[model samples]
Target: MMGVKQFPEFRSERLLDYLSTAVMVLDDHFRLMYLNPAGEVLLATSASHARGKAIRELIINADMLTEHLSAAMENGYVINQRNCRLELPDLHSLIVNCTHTPITLPGQRNGTMLELRKVEHHLRIAQEEQLITQQEATHALLRGLAHEIKNPLGGLRGAAQLLEQEIADAALKEYTRIIIGEADRLQNLMDRMLGPNDIPNMRGTNIHTILERVRELVRVEADSGLRIHQDYDPSLPELHADPDMLVQAILNIVRNAAQALEGEGEIVLRTRVQRQFNIGNRLHRLVACIQVIDNGPGIDEQLREKIFFPMITTRSDGTGLGLSIAQSLISRHQGLIECSSKPGETVFTILMPLDSKNES
Candidate 1:
């Protein structure tokens, strides 16, 4: 019989390195012993730098972690937490489900193994998919409705104009004039509802310049009491987009912010580059994150969900088509917009691809 072939001793280290969930090892004293790639990413640090550091120092809320470690060490079993919060070095918090297992070997010091996986990531992805699906359906419905209404509008306006020209009595002519003016207004509204028709004339465009143009336009329209500020990354790369469409999209958001401030608080236009970001269902290597933030009464929770839909508005004078059209324009550039608001702050973020690489 041939000698039994043994694969170079099964290496658990290799398997741990390839796992997507973060895994870490701590010595009996709760000092960091090992960290895989995923662990390093979650902690936002290199494994070499993390080694020998106390677990309490590396992660926030150490009291809970100590309990889990003690349980595993004394019980010689595994302890799993359904949901826990871990504050990473980057100052962001992740809600994770963690597992702690004690490693006890003959004639060797005991150690603990930890596995952490973020729970919010999956929830966020599902929410994004649903929003995208809803937006697409709304766009299709609006296009069909606009087309049906547009033809009748033109005929009504033309007839009113002809009637006004043929009328002799000034009083009677005024009726035709009113009809013509109202028809014209309705036609303009229909055109806006139809949203952008032209394809985005994409090219390498500077994001900051597009923002500056919007800032100037808003500055002209808003009251002098309203202050507009810019926080831009000068080194940001040019994006492939239509400059005109970008202006319209960003202007819509900024204008909304200005209006929310009621003409006094500050409105900030912030731009930054994000790496390994996700937009809708697709993942990109790099993206431009532009934010329109205001220190005003935040958006109402009831209106937040429907804010992007056509004709949804909290203000009586608002037509409510601005944000809907803005979303459509940004979607044309393979991007998406997300909003988060509270009592004193509201932020509308637009994420657009900065490069063609790693598009999923």
Candidate 2:
């Protein structure tokens, strides 16, 4: 039997960079010595800034985690904790599976290797898969229904035109015109229900350009009492997408936020780059996260889940196709749209994969 070959020190470090789990090495004093890329994401800090920082400084309210690390290092024992909760400096919390193993090197002091796997990440992947399947099924059913409704609508409009020509009385012709008008309206509605038909005109595009277009249009249409703000990450790379489609998708969400605010509250458009994100079953190394946040009465819990379905609306005049169409457009670009609402805050997040080569 062949023995496994040991990787060189640099090669091992390179291998750690590709791991999905967050890995960190700490000295006996619990000061950060090494941090992988995944670790940087989890801690929300860069390796250069985090190196030599105490573990306590990086993770606020980490007494429990610190205790575990201390015991592992002192006793020279490996410890595994499931669903360990850690508080971050930004006040965000994470539920992760933590593994602490003590290690010794020839010329270096004793250290502990800490591995963190986010528990919620697994759950999110499962939920995303379910959401994608549900959306596909819903879209398929709507397309079938629209096709059936459109055929009869075309015949009804044609008959109305023919009847109008045969009628002599102007009063009776008025009724035919009304019928024709309504038939045409219904035909347009059916087309909207069917969603976009053309393939996206994909090209290298900047997300900020699309967002600015949406902001300008929304600002013009919104009431004077409503305020729109932008918090953008200028470091984001150009996204490969259809600019027009992205504009339409983002516009729909922003408009909905403005409406949710009843044209009297605040709306913020924020952008960031999320690393190692999963959309449905595929994982991308980088993703563009765009958020439309509103301070409003918020969506009712019962309607939140069905908000993306056709004809489901909270407003009396709403066609409810805005969000559905928006979702479809983002989906066409291998992205996802998610919503979360509370009494005072509502957020619509659009996640678009940025690394096409890493998608799998």
Candidate 3:
């Protein structure tokens, strides 16, 4: 304990001034007693602004942090939680891991040491970079496969056409023509599979309009027996995305839900506005959430989580590209797609930042 760092005087205070993890110490009662300099940095508040104030004063939900620490305080205050993101005052987001230890000062009845360490913003940045690399590799492999399959099909289609020309039997000619047509169809499918020019130049547009359009299209194309519900948030803002790509993304998820329903179940398209969502270190201005929920038998246990992966589908006659493409498009927009399913409930949640304002 001799080498351990205890609360020092002037020098310690000076050191706290230069620290950057937004470290804070709470008392046994879960009140904020002290905040170090580094803790101030991540939290965007200085010790003077927060010290001696209840943690709830600066955090919108004081209970969120206190609730976690309460058990530790009661039973010796030893907890280890890491990289947790909490919504702070004024919609600021902070990522911190905390440990609490009961600190009995000279036989004090109740006292504790709460240590919070902030994860560097770069940690999340690194993860995003890794995901982008994976995305690039996926596209490269898809392109290579498309070329491999299309090259041989061209010759097959040519051969069928030549045989058709030489065949004197009407039935044989018709068969050859069918072969060419099918080959061409496959070739076109390959082009789409390769996904050329799928995401166009992005522009700012109202998301409500796109959602309405998608709703109208779903109504027209979906089975008459199936009912589609729409709940739009009037306060939701515009999104910076290619209208075509987003439409395709939403349509794909919704269509999949509808198909899962088989036209008799209910499909709900709900939208809302959210703030202080930290995908990593960035606090979004607003996130436009489009959720596609269906009342069906729910996704299979083996496939529910894996359904977004390429070529993973429960239905026959599906290329298994729709959901994959939808996810890819949404990822490109710096958004995320999450799916969860249980008996009689399946929800696909799409979280896209409105207008790509990710700063702070």
RMSD (CA, Å), each prediction: 6.5, 4.5, 8.9
lDDT of each: 0.86, 0.90, 0.74
Q: Compose the digit string of candidate 1's lDDT tens values, residues 297-343.
A: 99888899999999998889999999999999988888888999997
lDDT of 2 by residue, 1-360 (tens): 122224555565688887878999988888889999999988999999999999989998768877888899889999998998899989999999999999874476788899999999999999988888999999999999999999988999999999999999999999999999999889899999999899889889999999899999999998999998999999999998999999999999999888887779999899999897878766678899999999999999999999988899878999999999999999998899999999889999999999762332
Question: Scored by Cα lDDT, where does model 2 land?
Answer: 0.90
1-360, model 3: which lDDT tens digit per residue? 422335565565567544434456676656667776556655668778777777777777667667777777678747887777777887977777777676664457565666666575557546655555665687679879989999999999999988888899997888998999999998988887777455467888777788778878888888888888888888877777888888888988888877888888898888897653444334454678889899988987788656766677778888788877887788778887777899799999888877464331
Q: Could you give me the TM-score of model 1 versus the true structure?
A: 0.81
Candidate 1 Cα outliers beyond 4 Å, as residue runs? 1-38, 62-80, 89-92, 99-113, 158-173, 356-360
Question: Which candidate number would show the highest lDDT if scored against the true structure?
Answer: 2
Best candidate per TM-score, number? 2
Model 3, global lDDT: 0.74
Could you tell me the TM-score of candidate 3?
Answer: 0.67
Model 3: how far residue 156 lies from native, Å:
2.5
lDDT of 1 at 226: 94
Runs in model 3 with CA error above 4 Å?
A: 1-96, 100-138, 196-199, 276-286, 355-360
Candidate 3: 10-residue stretch with minimal lDDT: 1-10
Model 2: how far residue 267 lies from native, Å: 1.5
